[model samples]
Target: MLIYLSIISIASILCLWSEKSYKKGELFLSGFSTFLSVMVLSVFSGLRNLSVGIDITTYGKNIFETVSTFGPSVAIDYYSRWADTGYVLFNYIVSFFTGNIHIFLGVSTFVVELSFLLFFKRYRAVLDPTLSFFIFNVVTLAYSFSILRQILSMAIIIWVYYLLTKGKYLSAILLAVGSVLIHKSAVFIILIIFTCYIITKFKEKINQRYLLLLMILFTLLSTIILTRYPETIDNLIDDLNISSIQLNNFGSPMRFILFLFPVLLIKILIKEKFIQNNEEYFLYLISLITMSFGWLGGINYSLTRLTYFIIPIYILFISKKLKIINKKSINLIIIFWFFFIFWWLIGRGSEGGVIPYIPFWKEYIVF
Candidate 1:
């Protein structure tokens, strides 16, 4: 944990010392630096040595069997593998050379981080790289898991952004299709990217307020039909069974913050005349609406899965806003993040510990 603090302090200092170089439009350099930061964190996941047996799958093994057919790709349970087809391939290909698991895990982790650099370069001057590094390291990227396919699918999506940057729509489609092959979860995001593309033409026809209203109406209607329309809702939930799983503890508080922070940050970007890019602003607006869906009247707490949709846009939106934030504000945000990370990390440790301690902060209990 101390190492985490060390990295943050070093990265923040580097960010401050040469702020002008970044402002001079050092797109490749900044993107590469952010990617490097993520790569470093990925390489060290082993040192973290954390494990959770949440994901697992299985099938009939060699009970005098010869030459297994269909492999774990088909045999493994969906939840155990994060339902990622890519993860299955990663472990499968590596199994052929040597049954050692760590080799594939390590390679996959390294590749994920490396591809992020490519993604960053594509986003380029459109984002603030320093802030990108800060979030990747401080957030959940360091946590390694057995769910390799989901991880690899995420890596592929990173590269997809580059394809969009180059206007290689065909290549983007191919990559997203490939991601779906590796993990079906990518299917939903593929649809999102497509929807976002269609909405881009509306840059001339529609405005943000109009977009926000449509988003709100869509979300409310979706929630109502899902909640009030019993037969349809049951059919869909029964098929997906996703909500039945333990909700991702994005620290529910973190969920609220990730949702609201974009509105605040984007407001700053708008004030600075920085958000005119059509595609970028559309993504930002979508994120704001996705989170705001949490507030709709009839929606139960199932919108948790929507985070997967919101995060990338938030990253883009916040990164753009960071460039306009004064150094003092960035420093303050960083400080708060450090203390937040520290408090969160130690609390997690205590929860995982054999005997949870009663910390002394609650002094009034004694009083």
Candidate 2:
């Protein structure tokens, strides 16, 4: 915890010092910095810390049963192949290297890094050319961009975007077909892509006015419906029988801060043409809508995790149009991340909880 605080302090200082360049391609150093911090902290989340709920996800424990199923479900703990496929595939490939642990990390790292690299490359053309490879692509992906199940899907989706923008329609379609096979969430994404393509095919402009207005209404309605009837939505999504994510535990009220981000972002980023010209804005808007849908889907339902599916769009939106440090946004940023400068010492991250501004009201009075 002390180390994490020190890291945050250093990053805050860095954030203060750097204004012109925040790293490159379409990502920010802050994003990568946060990821590095999480990686280090997660080392402690082993058997002793997050020792419960079975997230280790190894082949040694249940490869046979994992293969028995179609790997269709997320329940790898009960012998689902979804988690074990990567593990099983890695075991054979790593027989040439050291132990399974090294192999696991190695392949995991490669698959993730390759996936994100492809994604950054796809958007590089329309993004801030100033960001090129370092801040936008490298730092962001290096951080924590691909640390989950659906990341491969993100990579492929961006490639689909690239092909679409570059006029490689056939290739884009092929990429979408490939992506859905990797993760079922890709299916929902494919639908969004096709819908956008159809809408934009002959449209004279990006048409932000109507899209923006409708999105605002949709967001409000979704938030109200979900908060009011969390149970009903929970039952709806959970009928597939996957374990429900603990929303109450993440102190989800903190996520309301997410809504604040694009708003705060637009405060400084509004004038930038990046929001209108770039194909990515469309993707970002729809993804944000999807995130709102995820929120409305249920409580304690992995909205944070669901947000991961849209993170690239978020980062791109920031780097392209919102990376600048204005007086207002800067002040708000401190408030945004820290809430109070002493939050770690007395509030959210103050206790041993590494998750910042989360678990909502679960206060831990650290001495």
* Best by the lDDT measure: 1
List the pairs of residues colliding in candidate 1: 55-80, 56-80, 85-182, 85-183, 86-182, 87-149
lDDT (tens digit, per residue) of candidate 1 on 259-301: 5654565476456464566766566665665465434311333
Q: Which parts of model 2 have CA positions greater than 4 angstroms off?
A: 1-54, 58-61, 64-99, 121-148, 216-253, 272-274, 278-281, 290-294, 297-300, 323-367
lDDT of 2 by residue, 205-316 (tens): 6656766676668668757766786564444222323233333322334444434454455544455543554365465566556546444433434343344455555555
RMSD of each: 7.8, 8.4
Assess the local accuracy of residue 277 in candidate 2 as a C-alpha lDDT between 0 and 100. 49
Candidate 2 colliding pairs, count: 15
Best by TM-score: 1
lDDT of each: 0.49, 0.44
